[model samples]
Target chain A: MSQPSHSSVLPQTELTRHRRLREQGSFRRADLDAILDAGFVCHLGVIVEGRPLVVPTVYGRDERVLYVHGSVASRSMAGGTPVCVTVTQVDGLVLARSVFEHGVNYRSAVIHGTVRKVTDPDEKLEGLRRLTEHATPGQWSYARQPNRKELAATTLLALSLEEASVKIRTGAPDDGDGPDADLGVWAGTLPLTATWGAPEPDPLLPPDIPVPAHIARREGTRHG
Target chain B: MSQPSHSSVLPQTELTRHRRLREQGSFRRADLDAILDAGFVCHLGVIVEGRPLVVPTVYGRDERVLYVHGSVASRSMAGGTPVCVTVTQVDGLVLARSVFEHGVNYRSAVIHGTVRKVTDPDEKLEGLRRLTEHATPGQWSYARQPNRKELAATTLLALSLEEASVKIRTGAPDDGDGPDADLGVWAGTLPLTATWGAPEPDPLLPPDIPVPAHIARREGTRHG
Candidate 1:
């Protein structure tokens, strides 16, 4: 598969700089896109009434803009608020000979930006299409498009991906050459994999209707 | 399995109350413990210099206290700061006949509290043990424990689980009886499941060494 287009490197602001694990951090914009594309759900962090609130929401990305949608009355959907959108995929558990070295193998991206509401009618529809297609491919074209009333009820916020941080940790544990390696304990990585199981048809659907090809093909396929 | 001891229901504080989708919210303390116990990774949300930052980390819980550990120098690990820790598990994709109704079936917990540093040596040791066992059961006793020097390098914070918000969305899409049902489009849930694969041994390990029974038995087992 062709890689997503990311022409420039991610700009590291004072907030995006890695303070702890500098080696695991990356400035490559491609890494950010890969991390974002590998998952659909993200945790949105916003300050509400002077306290931080982290909410789980589904998101989509088109080039440099990441789109998140919610109800119009949702507090986190308020436009122009500074938000932190984080997407993480846990790949495995790194079993080490020492408890101190045990860690998770994962990839994560943190995007820090002020969210802008999509007020334009055309952009709003297109943003919604991206959001739907991001979660389930081919559904945007196969399903019924939104009407004016549905469009007005939803709130879509766009966040720039320019200021983002990507960190990835993989491979075996770091204690292979340490003192714990001599302890005769088993040490390796127990990989974790997620896959799509058989699609369960809606109980209320007519028995004559069959599952769509787009949805059927995803069965047994790997997910982030 | 016996349920964890929870004395009372979670207090519905001003912050924990669900402003939107109130029907999906729950104040039951048992629900909070179940959500926390099912996952090991969480997104830590904190304000650093007035900007919201979300970091992914591992956590453990002991009755009313949830412990999270990180490097002492990590900026987001600062003690005594008001923080939000969120744990989410995506069960499936809720595919609807209408693009407007597309949603994800998930269970998530948002914890809001001021984190206190575990300064006492005995408590610190116990906290670390809980964290280790939480992530990898049976490994705590199999592997070498952290030394005093290692403990000094780590920073552990305890957050009370008294104030938390639990929201769960499950089953099929809500548009089964709506107008979109006449469109002859597929509508159902594509279940997602994570499982543990075979353990990969370190390349430099002795050939005679075998995978431990605890880790070996977990292969092919389902994960949250």
Candidate 2:
């Protein structure tokens, strides 16, 4: 009945803490930052017109500010709204013999904060740069810069990353405690993995040009 | 000044749809269903006291009802509050020489609806079944059913899937029209994938038992 506290330690947070699988839930700051930095797109959760809205968008980050962009009239970018943004990456499947025990090996970050619309010209320019470069490390310098009209047409919101938590699940299933153990189920982790593949050349590419070494060598590597 | 409508044309449900990269957005009801059916854990987006909350949760589904369970005190399942539930699977990565053209191969489902607290005994039991079966295909039959006390302590919300949309991106990079095309920049999709690994037996399991065939056969196959 009292005012709802948005603090990270709200009573509800205590409930979500790893109950059966304690190691999977983390309160560490670095863990949350790492998971968020490795991903570019996030599901932006907000309330519009008393209804919840979860819109996916590209995100850019500075040390403390997380920037998200959309069209000027986009519902997600409505000024002064409180929003929660989440980034998640699934690393593998934690397969168990008993279906009840199956789980996933994943890393996820959830940030809760109030979003403020950016209006200053310099801050807007810098925000777009961060967004572009966040997606591709060297992209801001390589591409054409946004013009005055382009900047005006875009909408950007900056939210502080001070209130957030990281929840991660790694390793195998937890079916060891029951009588079902003797059920003769072959149970072990069949690790699921994802890695970058070779970059293909565009078909219309001119014959003489060659691939850049940095981009070419990045193939077959882990992305985040 | 009036409240902006969040609903869009059949395909443009999410904000990403209006971007220049329209091809990256998709709308198919079946795709949404399949992605949700395949996944167990979901990032639940909710609003509490005008602020947004994205909490990772385990969900189950019947034909129209998507049941979400939480502790009775969870802010996410507050009675009558609106919520958005999203389930996504990133299948592959799209790597283009030009960073602007880079993208990902993914299947994602977004359900936008109001929450109806499940109070009926029949629906509640059925919801629990769907939830357990969703995690493990045959799990409901194998495990002890939830007792009345457990049901009373648990909070379940049934949300309609009627206002949902599926957005999918697949295949190669979209760098065919840019100047980078002539630069011979490597432009192809680095296929991303997820599959089941060998299952690890519970440490306490007796030495004689073997794994079940239904789960055993899923080894190395893609799972939600």
Candidate 3:
């Protein structure tokens, strides 16, 4: 028998195994990267005082690591903590004939890792820059970079991308051939899209300054 | 001294307490309701085998309960499990003159509660109806409802909405008067909006079937 393809496949460990709906799970490393690249915001889950706490945080990722930033005073940004970060993008609604077959067309990636707080000055700055540029491309050079004092007050957590799971569902819903098909109810997919709108200048900003090329061009562009 | 308004405010519990970013926290019951109503998807954080697991799932909420459904075999949907569910809607990006001052304008709600599995057939059906309708109004009535066997294969977890926290950030970015303001780089808010696009009928659907009023009317309407 030919050897199973492992060149570009993500390693499946106990944490990354798909326990349910295995059909939706993807083992390709490219799938994980695509899911992470499509969104800049992720919900971070960490155990706080023996209970789970989910926080909505902004994130940026490189090929090897996912970077999340927060205020130094934030409780969840501590280093060496095991955390789960999930980024989800809703593509549309799967309008099946039956409620049981109805589902969401979405792409999501879940990452499991221990976060390491960046204390080194250079990596911290670079991590922060990636975080900024991830959310708004071309933003790092456009905005003022963080200074020592400003950087001191911020915490950057770097999570490895090795342990990750990707699940994507698209197209029409199930039940077209199922028993519910006899019901004759309408069935289809309703596409949902997030777009960036025109930039509203800061009220205090001087009118002479025009919207930047990077920011202005993003109008009507897809986000998440 | 006059008593602080307590009638409309959510009870402050240890889990709902906002330790950091006090300015973004809200105790108002109406705020929590509004945030929950604005989105149908939530990130559910649950402790699985001593490690935090975050899953992106669809959710629906009533005044006192938030319902989440999944296959009965799903591990995180087990009853008596303590879970944290967070719903977030990104409104805009705050482009500050300084990277340190940059932020996201968003509204989010975090809920902490023990999930109760719905066993009563009536309540289970009702919960499923709410879940369907939450994602698509009039969907429950228009689509074929679940039968007895289908309900048996599904799990519905009901979470109490009594303990929750709300945070909303809007408007222009900070740094208007900060040292970075003098840098003269442009700063503003780029609004992000999610809208429903035209429905695409299932390829297997009969050509005579037209998009229903309930689904077609939502085209071009703002979602989250």
Candidate 4:
């Protein structure tokens, strides 16, 4: 709950300002990193042909840059346009005594900036590595790296994490002391948690091929 | 999976066209219902002051309309704005032998339309009920409903489900027969499942009050 250290804190800009629920907003760099590291999937929001399109995609972060990839033909992945990348993790559902006060306990980070395609071969390959490893740790070294032709078919865009907004909500409902507290209704939070279940091998795989240790260790472990 | 019944299929529009990955797209109305019923949270995408913003909020669906509410002071909740609401449920992580083939198993729906404020009192009340029960089943009748002042302070906007795009991805990775299959590396899916843990009562609650039956029943149950 403490603010991130000053040196690592993100600078507050016009776009990063918390207009609502200011108490739940955090400007700490550590807080931003924690939220980003906790989840690999993010919704990329961009203006496509004068319309707002939000597409879910996998992402990775290296320092202050966030990388997202999609098919080269994807209109949303085209570079030079401003984008909003959002990563949200719902921790629990807040059930109050009255429907008016209901809310969710979640941690969300939204990054607003212009994205540029990574054309340099080295950075593109490195960006792809970070993305793969971000979703599945140890998979980068374990799997066959993408070849030149494959990389050419993919579009990688990088956005700066400088202008980002982070919001985290926790604890009980806000109506505990309100007028509805006397309603005699049971009210609290129902925590939501996701875990990695056992790996389901491909039906065509050889029966003797056992699951790798890195993948096997994640079974029953919490995700995000 | 087979398509939903003909009577319930969503009509495809220019906006809902499956421009990419046509194989994973569906026009089945039942597919949209299943995706919405499984989760109550959605990301609201809209153009605010010329910039696209994506906000996470709770939602409820009644037939052909989706209802989302926020405080009247919320900038993102204003009416008369064109919006795109997206709901995504991540089922699993597809681990492939090559980074190029890595993907996720998920079901997602993207809704595009202009939002209108709910002015009718009856429909507003019904919409609130759907929102409450959608998050916690049976809670609408269990708890005290919203009062006059509470309802006045809330902004309820309705968006038609007519223009929606559905995409579902399941099963194994597509690189089984590709060049990377001979690398002897592990390739499969790590299923991700979320469940509701035991409800944690408020600290100030009296110990004599037992958890409601409807709430207790959700414990250890799968969440979308």
Candidate 5:
């Protein structure tokens, strides 16, 4: 077997061991990276002044760390604090005949680490570029870079993905072994999906700017 | 004008305020309810043993409080615990010409409150019904309720929506007024939407089991 890369981006947590519903949890490093790359937003959980905070923030990732940005004054990102970031995509609703067996099929990752403030000018610029491209591919090269003043007002933090785990659930609910099997009730999953809709151009466009192929082709495609 | 009901949930701390882009912050009570009603899954943020934990859990709502449940063995539903619940829906992407101005147009509601264990037998039954309907509308009344043994192994918590805030952002990006506009870069919102697709019946479902109107009509509808 090929050895896994010992990168900080890889999940290396003890609790990450697949337990209850063992088949649902995976240890593939590629799985975590793929999920993070396909998604742009995450809920960053942190204790701010001793209060638990789970704020949704835009994020990007390099090979080693996940970067999240906010306003310089954001209480959630200020002071180079420690935080736990979780990115989740609900794949489907596991509907069982019995309420006790009802569950959801999902893909989720939880990262635990300190979000050190990215103060170096070069890293900050690169961080912003990663964030922009993460949201809309090729948009970074298309748009003007932020000036010094804008950069100064922004706060970016890089959190290692080392202490993380990926938990996934799929297929139907496990209602077979229980008495629920004979309940005469309907049981299965309603596959929940997120897809890209038709691209609506800016109303004020000179009417000459054609939609980029990358953006246009994404229309109606399933995301995550 | 008739005064709106103060039944609106209120924001408690500065951290909960719409600080970065104050204009997007919505204080209207209806906004809170609408966001909550539009979502069935919420990320519950709580501290366990001084370490923060963020768990995505399904929730049901009534006139005054939200109910969450899980296996009685779930560490997430410990009673008398303080937790913050957040429900977010990403409606669109604000893809401004300038990367600094790009953002996600989203509607999110955050509730900060303590979770109380429900002991009353009747309320537990009602809570289970609400949760069932929350996941699969019309199925609660159609399916068999949980038996006594199942109830003994389930945990339920009630969290008041008394202290909460709704934050929303919509429309195009704020790149129209900057020097970035002179770069002649395309700028506008790339709307992202989530909708329900055609319902696929359970393969094991009897071929004669006609899809109920409530479930069937949800085909191609927007998810709440």
Candidate 6:
């Protein structure tokens, strides 16, 4: 299937449209970009041998494509497969009076496309570069670049960001105004925060080397 | 597919078998239990029409079955569909000297089974209770229980935990003994920690209501 949307807002397709909970859906392309940027790891779902397989893998994205790499033999890394890449940032739990009304405060984006195996040497380099920089910025230049053999063993799959769905749920529980409010059960949100901790130096590292500024700055920072 | 394994280790079914990175795979059933217990949210993958769809949803599990609830109308909530439920907890980013060796320290469990819809009301209530308690302990007792109407609108799917593949990656990168270690670029792990923050009371909550002790206890505690 071809996705050819040029509008600023993501064009709705049968795959990207929200059939239920329409209010939680977003048509804005920027919202999709933000959700993708907030997390480096994503759950990639693909059909393997007539069965659905979901794997967690680190990813990087450019203006229009999401790049993920894995070992060449992995099921999710197969080229030309229709893949659903989902990135979710769970912000908190909405503790409502009723268990039925409870919800999770989160930002999630699902992108659907036929993954194209990156083959061009220059494009593959760029994709791998984006993948490294996406997870740990400035480390691309600091780390040794992938040599030809390393690149060959790695499979980088690129999926277009053209067809995507973005959903962000924030704030209080949905049962605040409902009849359950009279139950007097304590209800609110317990926010969840992901933070980067201090860098643990590799045991084999020589003592003379210090944590780089870029890596050091990430400590204690919000991850998603 | 019939999964009738009685051993402490998960049976190596065609679906659960690991093709690559054989060293990272774990066959122990207890390992799968630990991975599932570490996280409440899971990425549920199912084939809709013909393409793959991955959704992030809250989940709970018991000794034999894993439970997840969603709106009855969701594509991922369909009954008797072959599904892949994957739960992953990212511990840290493994930064190595070469970009090619970069990896994620994570614990993940992937289960494949045909989902069974809860038609019995008693099992439905128990499943919902387990789900609520999974995300927030003591929540089911503190919150208002689900009524008939709410239960009808919800769909609970049960997948057997018997067929699962567990993989846990910990410690430093694998390139320490490789040639890239001579590059002199600092390499180690930047740990990721998920913690519960101070509860944000709902704006509509009565001022006299205090935060529940169970909820308060989670604050400043490690999650996943």
Top candidate by DockQ: 6
The segments of candidate 4 whose C-alpha lies over 4 angstroms from its true place after superposition are A1-6, A71-73, A76-78, B1-7, B71-78
Q: Pairing residues by index, what is the TM-score of model 3?
A: 0.95
Best by lDDT: 6
Candidate 5's C-alpha runs over 4 A off are A1-4, A7-21, A71-80, B1-6, B9-15, B71-79, B202-206
Q: Sort by TM-score, best first.
A: 6, 1, 3, 4, 5, 2
In order, candidate lDDTs are 0.85, 0.66, 0.86, 0.84, 0.73, 0.88
Residue-wise lDDT of candidate 5 within A1-224, one digit each (tens)? Answer: 12356642354454444445667667777778877886888887777666676777889988778889763125555555667777888877777767777887788877777678888999999998998888778878877778898898788888886677777787766775567667666676677777877766566555676676767777778777
lDDT of 6 by residue, A1-224 (tens): 22355566888898888888788889988788889889999998888877788888989988888998764225454567788899999999999999988999999999999988888988899999999999999999999999999888888888998899888888899889988889888888999999999999999998888999999999999999
Q: Measured against the native two-chain assembly using Cα atoms, what DockQ does each of the candidate structures obtain, in the order listed? A: 0.75, 0.35, 0.75, 0.69, 0.52, 0.79
Q: How close is candidate 5 to the true structure, as a TM-score?
A: 0.91
Evaluate residue B11 in candidate 5 and report its C-alpha lDDT on the 0 to 100 scale: 52
Clash counts for the predictions, in order: 0, 24, 0, 0, 1, 0
On residues B1-224, what C-alpha lDDT tens digit does candidate 5 reach at each position? Answer: 11355445465566566665778778776788788888888887777556566767788887678888752114654566667788888876776767778788898887877788777878888988888788778987776678887787777888887777678888777867766666667777776766666655566665665666766677677775
Q: Where does candidate 2 chain A have its weakest 10-residue lDDT segment? A: A1-10
- Per-residue lDDT for B75-190 in model 2, tens only? 44656677778887766545565544555567777787778888787788888788877765665665445567767756678887767756677776766676556654555554
When summed lDDT is taken over every stretch of 10 residues in candidate 5 chain A, the lowest stretch is A1-10
- Assess the local accuracy of residue B196 in candidate 2 as a C-alpha lDDT between 0 and 100: 62
Runs with alpha carbons beyond 4 Å of true place in candidate 3: A1-7, A71-78, B1-7, B71-77
Flag regions of model 1 displaced more than 4 Å. A1-6, A71-77, B1-6, B71-78
> Measured with DockQ on alpha carbons, how good is candidate 3?
0.75
lDDT of 4 by residue, B1-224 (tens): 22343357678788888888899999988899999999988887877666778878889988778998753124654566788888999999998888788899999999988888887888889999999888988988988887888777777889988889999999999888877777787788999999999999977666777899999999999999
Q: What are the clashing pairs of model 3?
A: none
What candidate 2 gets wrong by more than 4 Å, as runs, is: A1-25, A71-76, A91-105, A118-133, A137-154, A171-191, A207-211, B1-27, B71-79, B91-102, B142-153, B172-175, B178-184
Off by over 4 Å in 6: A1-6, A71-79, B1-6, B71-78
lDDT tens string, model 4, A77-181? 556678888899999888888887778899999899888899999999999999999999999988888899998888888998888989999988888887778
Residues A135-189 of candidate 1 have per-residue lDDT tens digits of 8888899988889998988888899988998899989989999777888988889
Q: Every prediction's TM-score for the first chain?
A: 0.94, 0.81, 0.94, 0.94, 0.87, 0.94
What's the C-alpha lDDT at position B78 in model 4? 57
TM per model?
Answer: 0.95, 0.77, 0.95, 0.95, 0.91, 0.96
